[model samples]
Target: MSRWILVGVLWLAGASAAFAIDQEIAFSDPSMNTRYLSLIREIRCPKCLNESIADSDAPVAADLRREVRRLMGDGKSDDDIKDFLSARYGDFVLYRPRVSETTWALWAGPFVFLVIGGIVFWRIVRSRLGQPLDDEESAA
Candidate 1:
């Protein structure tokens, strides 16, 4: 039993090495490195769904990080890189997708629901206000 436990402890210690990002990208300009970091945080990992590329350990996130660095080296503006990725991967790749006709519903849906809820609440309260208190409760 002690032998198996030692093996398990060794396995757990080595497992974290797999999660470390092994890339050695070097940016000549500090600003470019900053931009690269920002872009990775803003872009969603295609495989991870909810994780930003910067936070995801998925292979696709690493590939996307490489592509972002390549684009920066090619002198592409941040918006241009984003546009390229958006065109290739669809708007879902962007953390803050452009508000267009298709996305208007997504942007406006919350406010619309809030307004409907307010109306429903107001109607319920108004109706209750019009009723008298219960006779037993009023006497008490």
Candidate 2:
């Protein structure tokens, strides 16, 4: 019976330690909480693209989330935090990269391609639907 009691105490202590280690940030100012949450949501987990760091359970994501909180506590603004993370992790860490000369293609290339594709598709459909002119029109 003494051995069982000892084991039970050990188990409870271990459980509490585990819980303490996983404790999340508790913001002193509620406004900071909103900013912190927004920053996390904009950050992508390198390991998990489908989930934001805020929603990811991966260890790396958790560490990144904690790092963001630390930066916020240190009075870093949102852009400063983003720039720090981007410099360390690259633009891939950002869920949405800003459009600029450096990233112009990344931002606008897709839409350009879509427009080109739509033009080609429309031409194909129009030709199939009897919109193609005859050789006489071409000669004129």
Candidate 3:
């Protein structure tokens, strides 16, 4: 029974080791590899809400990774590859999408809201100052 237990432990360890293989794609040019890493991290996984391609394990992420590798091997520029993916997946695929007629609102919405909020805040403060405080409120 002790021998069987030892065999079971060994088998479990070996099975885990077999499944621990790291899958990495290497390029002959170090620059190409660096660009690949950067692109993966910069590209969002379409199937995931907020995960990058580098961090996502979705089937679409895997397909995108393979496509990126193939595009790089074909000597496509980083921008060219990004444009191709954008064309297929829309600007959502990019972490920082370029500003365009369609995306102008996305880039400017926060600042516009901030200015409106500031104006509203100023008006509220001005109106409050114009009112005389009640005796109880002033005492507090």
Candidate 4:
């Protein structure tokens, strides 16, 4: 039992080591480093769905990190870097996409769906309860 446990622990350690991602950041200025960290935290990895480039281990995430760093080194503002990524990968690359015509559905879709659902639910409940929808209908 001890031998089996030892093997299991060693195997788990090796697996964890293999799955570890590089968390290094190279920036000359402290402010740039701060911005870089912020950018990474705010930018989603296109290939990783819900994971940010900072948290994802995918190759695409590494590539995005490199691109963001390079853009910063080129004196691009945070907005510029965000725009570059958003232009290339669309609003999904941005964790907080701006509200615009193209993204209106993304911003308002849930509420619209909720309102529609509420109306349907109200109608279903009213019908099941044999309640009249209007006073005129009840009188007739």
lDDT scores of the candidates, listed in order: 0.80, 0.78, 0.81, 0.81
Ranking by TM-score: 1, 3, 2, 4
User: How would you encode candidate 2's per-residue C-alpha lDDT over 5-121 as one tens digit per residue?
Assistant: 997786555444323434643364646755666678899998888888877889998889888888888999989988989999888898889776789899889899999999999
Is 1 or 3 the stronger prediction by lDDT?
3
| Winner by lDDT between candidate 4 and candidate 2 | 4
TM per candidate: 0.62, 0.59, 0.61, 0.59
Q: Please give the range of 10 consecutive residues that has the lowest summed lDDT in model 4.
A: 14-23
* Global local distance difference test of model 3: 0.81
Ranking by lDDT: 3, 4, 1, 2
Residue clash pairs of candidate 3? none
**Cα lDDT of model 4 by residue, 18-135, tens digit:** 2354434356464566567767889999998999997898999988988988898899998999999999999899999999999889999999999999999999887778754588
What is candidate 3's lDDT per residue for 1-140, written digit by digit as tens?
99999977865554443233216444546567657777888999999969888778899988898898899999899899999999999999999889999889999999999999999999999999879999998999
Candidate 2 regions with alpha-carbon error over 4 angstroms: 1-25, 100-102, 109-140
Instruction: Tell me how far the alpha carbon of residue 23 in candidate 1 is from the true structure, in angstroms, after superposition.
Output: 5.3
Mind sharing the TM-score for model 2? Answer: 0.59
Score candidate 4 by TM-score against the native.
0.59
